[model samples]
Target: MSFRKTGAAILALVMAASLPVAAFAEEEKTIEPTEVTFWHGMSNTQEQVLTELTDRFNEENEYGITVKLVNQGNYGDLSTKLTASAVADELPDLAQAYNNWLTAYTDKIVPLDEFVENDFDDYEDLVEGYRAECEQLGFIGALPFNKSTYVYFYNKTMFDELGLEAPKTWEDMLAVGEKFMEEKEMPAFGVDDLAGFLEASLAQNECEYASDEGALFDNEAGLETLEYIMGLYNNGYARLIGEDDYFSSVISTQRIGGYIGSSTGVSYITADDFELGVAPLPTNKKAAANQAGTNIVMFAQDENQQAATWEYMKYLTSTEATTEWAMKTGYLPVRVSAFESDEYQSFMADDITATAAYSQVDAFFPAAMFEASNAVRTSVNTMFEEVVLDELEPEDALAEFVQIINEECDVE
Candidate 1:
């Protein structure tokens, strides 16, 4: 069967079994609607697409559920506000939350396993890796929302002009950047998130930043990762997009020949003067890319509101909806069914750049999922700045940062 036809068949079966026929028929007689509030960090184009999808769900779903989406600026701001709301007992019915952020409110969030098993027959269709990442403390704490993986975004025109192939490993990446520096007199690579870059690089070297035991990135592999990145910075072959935006460094300045960034950022990367190319991040001991993005968490609400929220959540992650989302934004589809859908295939055919993230899905892994994950990321980022910008020696900087993170993070 065709991908679309298969999805449609499974969806029909799942929806038929989602709610009891007698209960659904009786509920249809109710005149009142269940009002659910959703707080999200989406803005600009992403927010627009989400609003359209949510509106469609509100209108088409069998249940009378009205979702009021409140924009919470960026993810960091949303995290802060959500934490405060949880304390005040004023949390929204649904919110976009990372695993670390969700860990802080375990008591206030509803586990999704019960709803998934009872209400959705196609729950097994969710991508296995995504499902595993969402699982916490024996229950699915959240559902994947706007997931993404890192990819190498390069200026194809520059590479073609120099007769250089895209880098496939860390050593090759530096060599390519050095060649670009010598030939074009500009840095060849820039990274928007140093922390994420470090995580992927460390994974390639079989190292973890931290675990329940403590910090694990202060060893040989970590030192090598730092030294190589700092070498590029010292040689004027690379730059870090600290406070400044990635687009400004790459597009506006035209100085950065390529960058390692989230695939979702593809829409923001403009190459009016050059051909843009997207590839999986370079590997070393192993192929690895950092998996990221928010998940939908349902708060502790009344039974009716909880059911309504689950319906919307399941709808958001449905094959049709996820395919539309991946096509509209450059984010990865959360379900395997979406990947197999004809709609996604057509969209990928038109612009393969957006699908670069999918190519790395099998190799993608999450960072530390504990509450201290954010602190570890901050420490690593600061360590990068100290080594590259402040000229701190790699070994000394790594040691100092590891100590700081261990003290601050209090792992286990």
Candidate 2:
């Protein structure tokens, strides 16, 4: 994929060759400066970095493009506001998006399939898994940004003292966790995001998470994955956030043997007392992890604003910008060049925990995204919790929630 071509490179040049050169070679029109409004949910340091980049682009880009950033609280708040704005036809020029969030309002958003195919050279530099959410739509609906994945972090010092090795597969995880549990009489393993863990596990085991007909997680393969997580919880081999707040906090305080959690979680873990270790998520029948993050999407607007928005969006995913974004924000870079850049390579050299996620980039894939996607995820989470807490039988819970989620997704 070529990234160097400017979006303004002879745009609107679809004249038939039969037309005389005199007709098509008229003087090129000068593009006026355009102000693009962008809505997002980033705050704190992330917001600071974004502001810094936007300010630089506004001041230095050859095209006079100004992007105004609007912080709309968190993602949930932004989603609700977007839907309302969609209804009122008052959407901003660009916004960050999850795959499912745009499915409901596709017409209002510009489909970038033609743009990327015709204008976005260097598309191949992007990680393939990042745009997978739009594969079903048959077009590039969004640009991947701030990508991350589930990673396994363990207490290496404790493992060595206990004569145990970090797990590489689900079977290893079960056996190792149970051995630690038996020895210490405490929970030995856990995951910070159960929903992401479940999704990645299903994919690893070749189970369909959802479809037009609804979820297939109650099937044999899906049940196997679900039960595996439940077994760890039921046998006291795994722990959940519950009343303890964050699992990362307990990782050092409670001395948990290991945990599967957000790839960016390394920054939050306190390693004062132990040698912390990080590794990619353990595999099962398949080696995979859930790719997590939002993508930037442009809403339909006037030609000038659209062009300016494209420049800003392109700048965000460029190799240099994405590499800097990842290093500062702890998110994965969107471009292969960014990932392999000297700056990023140096950062990865000093950070083993980040390597845990980056090493498995090839195995990363986003979960199925469609209408009511988050609803289905919540259903799966509830079902898992019910079974683990002994509030319902696994069979009953799975059967019930699968149907309920299907109805919520309007699958019939």
Candidate 3:
């Protein structure tokens, strides 16, 4: 199915008509320089690029805004700190947040509708998929920042030597995986996130993991998805890489032939001794990939800080900045204009692996959302372990899993 455009249509309806002329004409108040503090979870190369860009914005922007970025380790740490800050009434002016974290602070976070309606002029330039992702829950909770999608990473050296082609469907994955297991005496596919895999697999079957009613993965489609995965494990064709780096395992061991993982991790997939190939996730019924990454969310602060935060947000997501981000990092650009830019074209030309993700952009979908989204994912992972490692029947495991998630989410 085509990527859902309903969110975009709703946003257009809510933001299309310009406000009264007086509303636009009466904005001449001179405010003092504002210092907007930002909390983020970037480290290493990503942190370096973000700091460079923030410094440029501070020194060059027309608005007198000084952005102070505080790296809070990884996303989990940032979310925890943000929660504590919320309780202490000490939240930063802005921070990078995933949908689940944003949902937790929805009441405390400021909606960008008024700011976008009045200040930003290039809303249409944003990629339709990323824009829809921002508005996935019926409103723009945050602006798209570093975005990525899932891709199939395979050992091209092995494929060529074995005269094997990349799998194009679930059946193909099973057949290829079984062949590798029998011939090579090793697992062919390794996955770090079973929940993410389930999301993609469900979408292929035209199903979803959650709904307004409750967890929806207890049906025939969900069973088939789990059974397919279990079949691979039972036959020694697949393995879950728990507490291990997938890329490193794939490279160091050189046992597994391929796996489905994030495009953001592509940079770490070094293959000096062999050839590494990246492709879109294998399809079953329809082509679908789960969109991954955090968005820049603004907390409700004073008017000046809010204004400054929006300026920085716009700058970060601008075509030029996003193109730079995509070039430096493995993440996808958040803007359609960025993808069309000469800079991005050159970057993609040099790194064909990065281009694999862009091809699946049209099929990207917002990940499953709920108040207890992370918890639900945890339960799904647990179920995967029970079924794959413990060898529990798919139907029995799914029944218990559905009950647990529905109770945790308080679904009627």
Candidate 4:
């Protein structure tokens, strides 16, 4: 027990103590599964389906993570909330957004590449054109969800009684409308807004609202599209109807002969005491086109939380999940695997209306935007509204609209 021996014994004891503490620290470092929050714009029937999926995930998943689903109201309201959340550093793990708004939120989002290497793998499972569109959005920007393409919706009972065939070319569509307006005292199409028809017209012509550089909807293709819309006004095939009139007569009880509307409207349209039928959008030539719907995007979150969010997102957009959603809501399944699967085909086979919608899947366009383009579409719509209501000359209105869009859209 001399001084040197005592010092050595004390040093050994200290090292032993440190070894046990370090071991305890290592043992306590197990990674805990993180909870994820999903904010969506779905309401009513759509809301119910989303909730059911989340509940199933919570009940069935092996991971000890909980998913909280929140209804953030409609798209506009949801976008507002999302922006506020980002400002406060309280953004949710996942958010549902349309492409237009998703563009604005790009900086705040977590690139999906962090989890999946090649997004094309996911794309390959979806329709080819749509897959290309998603791939163009850059590394795993969003998961396509809640998709829809526009179609011509007609009342089967009415169409049969009138003996009218579904329109193929734009001329056929107008001819059908002329008969409906003059003889049956019914309009061919009705909607709260005119922009839908304008886009449909552009689709009919194999033209887009914007080019790759982002020109608005007032180019040559745009003007031709507008002219057709003007024809609908002059020919009396349609009327200027708001949401109230649309749901009441043109839609609900099926008083109207035919109308252009979203394919996703299938479930709601069928539920209102009418037998509904769907046809491809009327085209200038014989082909067809319409815009696809929204996608799911993840905002910036911590690493563990980001991983959990993607796990739930994959479930939401998986072939199985999208198939269920397609069946329940009458939405087109975005996944090619889902569309080609027997389960999906069988679901459509049992329902002719859904089947018709399914057949038109080959004609959808990816949603995109143009530079300073707001004025173009809005101007075209305004021209239609004025002409239909007899507020402006069709030629003058369109000419002015084209001029305005061209001026604003010019490259510097």
What TM-score number comes out for model 1? Answer: 0.87
lDDT of 3 by residue, 67-98 (tens): 99999999889999999998898999989988
Poorest 10 consecutive residues of model 1 by lDDT? 24-33
* Model 3 weakest lDDT span, ten residues long: 16-25
* Pairs in steric clash, model 2: 1-121, 1-122, 1-123, 2-121, 2-122
The pairs that clash in candidate 4 are 125-336
Model 1 per-residue lDDT tens digits across residues 1-412? 6999999999999888866865786755332378899999998889999999999998997778889999998988999999999899999999998878866778888888888887774877876667777885458888989998778888889899999888988898889988998899978888878877777777888878776556788788888876776677888778767567664356444667888877887777667888888888888888888887888989947887887888889889989899899888778898888988888887887775656777777787876666577677777788777777776666776777678678767753
lDDT of 1: 0.81
Report the lDDT of model 4 for residue 390.
Answer: 71
Quote each prediction's TM-score. 0.87, 0.88, 0.89, 0.83
Clashes of each: 0, 5, 0, 1
- lDDT score, residue 372, model 3? 78
Candidate 2: list runs displaced more than 4 Å. 1-30, 134-136, 391-401, 407-412
- Poorest 10 consecutive residues of model 2 by lDDT? 1-10
Taking every candidate in turn, the Cα RMSD to the unseen true structure, in Å, is 9.8, 7.8, 11.4, 5.3
lDDT per model, in order? 0.81, 0.80, 0.81, 0.69
**For residues 120-139, could you state the per-residue lDDT of candidate 2 as single tens digits?**
74988898788676454567
- lDDT per residue (tens digit) for residues 202-268 in model 4: 7767676554444455567666766677677677777777445453345666666777766766565
What is the model-wide C-alpha lDDT for candidate 3?
Answer: 0.81
